[model samples]
Target: MRTGILSEVEDMIVDEVPIALVYNGISHAVMMATPADLEEFALGFSLSEGIIAHAGECYGIEVENGPGGVSVELEIASAAFMALKERRRSLAGRTGCGLCGVDSLDQVCRPLPALAPARGFHAAGVRQALGAIGARQELTRLTGAAHAAAWCGMDGVLRIVREDVGRHNALDKVIGAMARGKADPHDGFLLITSRVSFEMAQKASLAGVSALVGMSAPTLAAVELAERAGMTLLAFARGDNFVCYAHPQHLAVDT
Candidate 1:
């Protein structure tokens, strides 16, 4: 319906499905996502949400497709499972909601250690990565509803990319892929196709990523957290222009 005109048309759209992340037979969280990378999403969620300390803590991951939706079952270490049981909060996540179903205000923000200093990032590299990322987003090209998160090297090369209907899920997939590939988070920066939110910044910082570049604007809380965590936060990245919200010193001008 365009301007009150009724028309019949068929279009390609991104898939948004409920993905249940079950840990040790306990259903922890269910998020609406693209459902392409269930294993990566499960690993990344567990790591970013502090459910497990590291990748080694997660012994195994199994993906199950059912009639209703997809389920990702994870087998974690006993210590990590005990910790998860002690502080488990059920999350009912939607596509656009990051903090839905939080049981308490205290659980809203998780504590993270300050990130190590990141160096050798140039503005030219940021622009180069931004330019190349669009072509790599196959799902976005097919369905405009998809969002992507990319891990780029300091030289602006795209190392890994993950896409989903939800921005958080994409980032989680990237994190999980990075872990699986043994990529060093501090040696590169994260590029996202969505606005910089506090949760997004926190997730990157938790993964020891020192910089984040976004194609949209950044929230106030995101800037403040990035500053406190010693992260380089850049947003509104279009073409050769971008706004550095925090730690601008890390982005050097290329000669």
Candidate 2:
């Protein structure tokens, strides 16, 4: 056993910490998330979760460290604050339970706004996106554990990329960045380095994203939801091919 003392290696684990969402002085929700791009995370969560209509509605944000983990305080408009209070918002909202508290079919099949049809995406472009996303993943390069979500332009160019240990958080950060940058949600497709879970689909809908492509397979529930929302869903984007779950008409197919 003494010989083992001579051997040691540096290791890396993805960073995660408690992110408290405080609205207007009330402590609302606490989430376990990577401590980066948090201002974007807060704004994106607000818009996607229907807490605020847009980034403008959020007045200010402050982040600090508490006894446990990181805390994010959001100052939103009076109208948005009233709406949040009306919902009896608690820790309202995802790793496993993307659709939590759903014990009924109606809740599971809740209505989603129809997304506009997406522009066709060529196979070559899909392949390029698959290849290109990996290079943009800086955190994953360092931690080897972060997931990335990218927004690809209609021309197959990668515009925005965000990474986190949680796939959903990565998506949120991207959305927030896009919103701040005035990127058109319907003008391009979203690609994530994670499975197409139902929450991913839901958040895409919230962000007005008409298309979603993932590097992994999509779940049956995700397919069903995509079909109803009128969003194009594609997964297993690799090589020169991908699988389409809904609205295959959106893929150019010729490329």
Candidate 3:
């Protein structure tokens, strides 16, 4: 430790690049995201943003790397492409702000899928998943700046983890990975390494995941919306402890 002499050193940072999502050769959105998992990001963003109903609707994905930014090409079904063209939501996401480019309230709360009724998850399982997630966050370990989203089963097994500079991007990546892996949305709960936001809850609901747990507190709006979507919202989740903001019926305390 030098006395008042701070030394400049290079550190491994999370790479944030502009990823343009293109559908049928038409640019739909350009988001600032971590460079890895372009295909998963494409698929996840498409599904989460309601661009495509399901992963099968996306025929293929192409990642074009460039000096400027990466372009993700999604060859989606004609029906989905037409829907995207009609909706025409070309968002330029700066960070994880879910409603960055939304112009009006009507556009803000778009239609979401009907999430099934709440399924019980053991308290011990949630605690185990929460405790295990820190070790699974590779990028957070590397850069300490990225957020992570992990899909944990009802039994509390950490199934998959994805990271990005943006929390929304991380969650989207997890959802996309789940879609590609054919993981049943009904079989698990999603845990995010960030606060619970309305859009985050909305995304989970759209994917039909019944539970959302966050490392930080939930916003009032997030809890309200999540309640409407039939999700069990838990936040401020620490070792052997968490606060359930909504739908406590779904959280079965392990005796």
Candidate 4:
């Protein structure tokens, strides 16, 4: 089971608070997320925001389990540290919501640069990856209060997984881990246990992964982003059927 403090159902209150990520003694953005996998959350946040190009850019990560929640102290490279500081300086703390803190509607729906078109991925392999994702979800299964993002290979091998209360956070964690571990994002597919959003699609593209599969629907913005990125976007993926939104040519559906 996922390691997290649990309260009985009906009495369970979702733990949400400001998690301040500090990089090389400089304060970065504060995210409101559940108090678990905080270290992963910090690294993931850093990667998704383009604060750190790779995991190795983070020299160290220290988690302080505090009263209200947790604080992540990250020792990042000088280059990434400067970028993080610039980002924080641009934010209006009072107006910014922790999860969706982009400048405007257009920024919120930023497009991903087009990538190499995907090779047709087998349906059976995709199904196997979906099942693997379900099995690896320790936190979500325990609290019924988390989202998961996984990186699975073309042959259904799950390379890495991350979980968070916020879907975006979960995806960030996965991407961060991949970058840190130097894993081959191009070797596999990306899967989410939540609906596909433009941000999610953007992150996947930035990670250079070619396909995304989700258990729910994709927003119109997300679909458009996937199309621009030349990535396959699969939604409503269930027992034997899935809706291919963009790049249907990349899916290996059977006769």
- Report lDDT (Cα) of residue 151, candidate 2: 89
**Residue-wise lDDT of candidate 3 within 1-255, one digit each (tens)?**
369888987789889999998899998789999998879988998898888899999999999998999999889999988877766544333445446446456877777666775565778888989889989988898899999999998888899898999999999999999999999888889999899988898889888898899999888889998878878899999888899988888778965
After TM-score superposition, the amount by which residue 168's alpha carbon in candidate 1 deviates from its true location, in angstroms, is 0.2
Show model 2 residue runs off by greater than 4 Å. 1-6, 89-111
Better candidate by TM-score, 1 or 2: 1
Model 4 lDDT per residue over 1-255, tens place:
236866554534456677888778766567778777677778877777677777778898998877766678999898877766666666655473534445554556444555776554778878888777878987777778888888888877788887778898888888877776777666788989999987788889888788899999899988988888889899998776788999888778668
What TM-scores do the predictions have? 0.92, 0.88, 0.92, 0.84
The local distance difference test score of model 1 is: 0.90
| Residue 125, candidate 2: C-alpha displacement in angstroms | 2.2
Worst 10 residues of 4 by lDDT: 96-105
Clashes of each: 0, 0, 0, 0
Error of 2 at 11 (Å): 2.1
Q: Tens digit of lDDT per residue, candidate 2, span 1-255?
A: 256576566767889999998889877667789999999998898887777888899999999988899989999999988877765443245134444334345545545777878766566667778878878988898889999999898777999899998898999999999998999888888999899988898889879898899889999979988988888899987766789999888777672
* Clash count, predicted structure 2: 0
Evaluated against the true structure, the overall lDDT of model 3 is 0.87
lDDT of 4: 0.79
* Stronger candidate by lDDT (2 vs 4): 2
RMSD (Cα, Å) of model 2: 3.7
Clashing pairs in 2: none
